[model samples]
Target: MVREHQYEAARFLWGEGAIERMGEVLAAAGVDRAMVVCGEHVGANEELMDSVENALGDRHVHTYTGARGDTPLGTVETGVETFEQHDADGLVSVGGGSASDTAKAISVFAAEEGRTLHEMKTQTTDDGESHIPDLPAPKTPVFAVSTTLSAAEVSNIFGVTDEKAGDKVVILDEKIRPRVCVYDPAATATTPASTIASTGMNALDHAVEILYSDGHAENPFYQATAEKAIDLLVTNLPAAVNDRDPEALAAAQLGAGLSGFGIVGGISINHGINHPLCARHPVSHGDGNSILLPHGIRFTYDAVPERMARLAGALGVEVEGGKATDEATLEAMCDVVRELQEEIGVPYRLRDVGVDRDDFEAMAEIAAHDSAMANNPKRVTASDIVALLEAAW
Candidate 1:
């Protein structure tokens, strides 16, 4: 068998006080004036914001607190306007996935003048093939300070919600990838425990989906990183989320960062389903991921049983005599995931997270068109998605 893969490497500064080096990182990236992008909650954290401001000092031009969950297109436009008005040469994205995504979208939208996000996004053909357009513009650099396990900073792709269409639009541009990433547990301490726990599941979903994704299944780099990510998250997430242990949180943060490496290899049905759920409804990305992960694993099992079974060891499942059938391993894996969710106190069902059963068909239809769905190991139809939603419900 022959396999080939490519990945982009970004400078990463991680540890207890990694964020203190923000000014130095910006200087190295040649960013003279920087804008801090964050959500209302993160922006309102006086201590955290003060630290960030103090670190950036004169380099910090403005703090945009309009970042919303789900990375709304409207918010991105507003952020782009703010970025231009402040004369910011770069962005420092603070908080979870939404803030990171918002900053990335702002960079692209700012660079690609006279174009809307809808015009720059991936489109589906009449025959159902995904067409991702080339974005050749040079985007403003982004320096990400991740505060959750969603790990959106490392990927070159970002999803923005088109409010009118009520669908998530994915845009891919290598230039929008963060120039540097800072992961400090101290920064995440201010985030809610439930948010941390749910996003940790979202990280786990990234690892699981990569291992079984048709495009990534044969890539050794993705396989190694994803396996290690799963191990670290499984071991540390409980302590990190429940007890708020800094050391444990740091370990989980590393897991989330490692999990992000596999994003270049591609994600599959899990994210395909999650994208629409978060876009059209009031669902958080992490909660949607948590609720859908087990069902996704089960759905892709038959197509990639060996790949799925390999996760047993990663999930800390023990076989009776060193070897068990894939079926047994599959059940054990799902059970372990459920137990982890329970220990972390995250919702386990779609209904528990305010997902309406009546919208399953519509969500499924939107999900079927997501680019990630094209990478599923098993062939997935909108009807299959509806059935999965029914089972999850």
Candidate 2:
């Protein structure tokens, strides 16, 4: 089989005090005035904010703290308004996925005037074909300082929830990719343990899906990065959350960043389902990933059994006699993931996270249309999604 892959690499500065170099990064990017984007909790952290302000120096123009979970469309609108009011030339995202996604959304909306988010967002037809409109306008550069493991900073994709429609609208634009990313473990230290744990699982899910996602499965570069990401997450996630070890957290952060490589290839059904699950419910994207990943693995196992079995080695699971049947290896892989989730105190069941069994059908309908579904190694139907949801529940 012949395959071609396209990947974009982002400049990353990682270390204990990497945030202090924000000014140099901004200067190199020719961004004179930058707005800091973050969630309320992050905004209230005076110490962290102080660090960011000092690092950015005179280049920091304003702070928009209205970023919310699910990257609500209204919040993005507010961010764009704030950006224009302050006359900012770039965005510096300083928190988790929501903050990064909000900044990405603002960059797009601010650049392309006269178009509503609904009009620019990726849309699905009645027959289930998805379309992403070309966003040719140049966007404001984004510099991300990640404080969670969601790794939204490195990808050109972002999701915004349509409050009325109760669905997440995904957008893809190459220009929205961050100009630079800072992975300071100290920046993540202030985030809650539960968030770190759940998002760590989310990063692991990204690596797992990449191994078998369409086109990517055959690409050796994607395979190597995904495997290394899995190994790093499996080894360091528990200590990062439980003991708050700086070294361990650094490794976990690198793992999360590497997992974002999946975006260049594609993600599979787990992320496709997680998008709607987070949009419709109070669940965090990380929690959604935590709960759905095992079921997604099982759902797609038969189609990519050999690739699935390879995950066991990456997960540090030792097979008996150095080999096992694919079915047995699959079970071992799931067991390893579930045990890691338990160790990290992330939810492993949909019911535990307040997901209603009755809403499964609607969630399935929306998930079936997600762009990530197009890359699933196995052909997936709405009915298949429903069954997976039921099993996870």
Q: What is the TM-score of each candidate against the true structure?
A: 0.95, 0.95
TM-score of the candidate numbered 2?
A: 0.95
lDDT of 2 at 92: 98
CA deviation > 4 Å runs, candidate 2? 1-6, 123-130, 318-325
Q: Give the clashing pairs for model 2.
A: none
User: Per-residue lDDT for 21 in model 2?
Assistant: 96
**What tens-digit string does per-residue lDDT give for candidate 1 at 1-393?**
665666777889998788899989998889999999999999999999998888998999999999998998889989989999999999999998999999999999999999877788774454646688888888999989998999898888889998788889888888988989999877887799998998899999999888888867778888898999999999999999889988889889999988998785458888989988988777899898888999998898777656765666677876554344567777888998999999999988888877878988998888888888877878788999999999888
Give residue 78's lDDT in candidate 2 (0 to 100): 92
lDDT of each: 0.87, 0.87
